[model samples]
Target: MPALFPLLRGRVLCSGALGGRKPDARVYARALAQLGARAAHTLFVDDLFVNVRGARAAGLEADTVRDARGLRRVLKRYGLA
Candidate 1:
């Protein structure tokens, strides 16, 4: 993953949590806030409702999708098409 983000110019690791952990929204939200982005200005997309709910709890707009078709529908509904 570090190789994928070699620039590492605007990245920060706030918590000691692993990326593979479930309900990582809290960690992500904190990192975003630390980087100067309000939760309301962020969008979180996940395949699991648990993660989505966690993100929403952190004040971000969250969505869950079961598959690619569902993701397309969600993007279209939000005028992201």
Candidate 2:
């Protein structure tokens, strides 16, 4: 993943690493804490609506994208592409 998106290197989080799963606000909190990031400044992207909603409920800007193209589109919309 890092080879394709260098900016993601050392910045990916999984359920195990965060000790929680999707749709859980605690998971988002843990991830933000680990990254030293503010929820308002973060853009959380997931393919599942439940996860995206969870992010939003946790006070983050969230989006859902099912493919790389969709992901790119969302990133572009946010000026991160």
- Taking the candidates one at a time, how many backbone clashes does each contain? 0, 0
The residue-by-residue lDDT of candidate 1 on 1-81, one tens digit each, is 234256446653425543334466657656676677787876667788987888787787879988878866776777664
Give stretches of model 2 more than 4 Å off. Answer: 1-4
Tens-digit lDDT track of model 2 for 1-81: 234467887677896778878988999999999999999999999999999999999999999999988988998898887
Residue pairs with backbone atoms closer than 3 Å in model 2 (clashes):
none
Q: How many clashing residue pairs, candidate 2?
A: 0
The whole-model lDDT of each prediction reads 0.67, 0.89
Q: 48, model 2: CA deviation in Å?
A: 0.4
Per-prediction TM-score to the true structure, in the order listed: 0.61, 0.91
**Can you list the residue pairs that collide in candidate 1?**
none
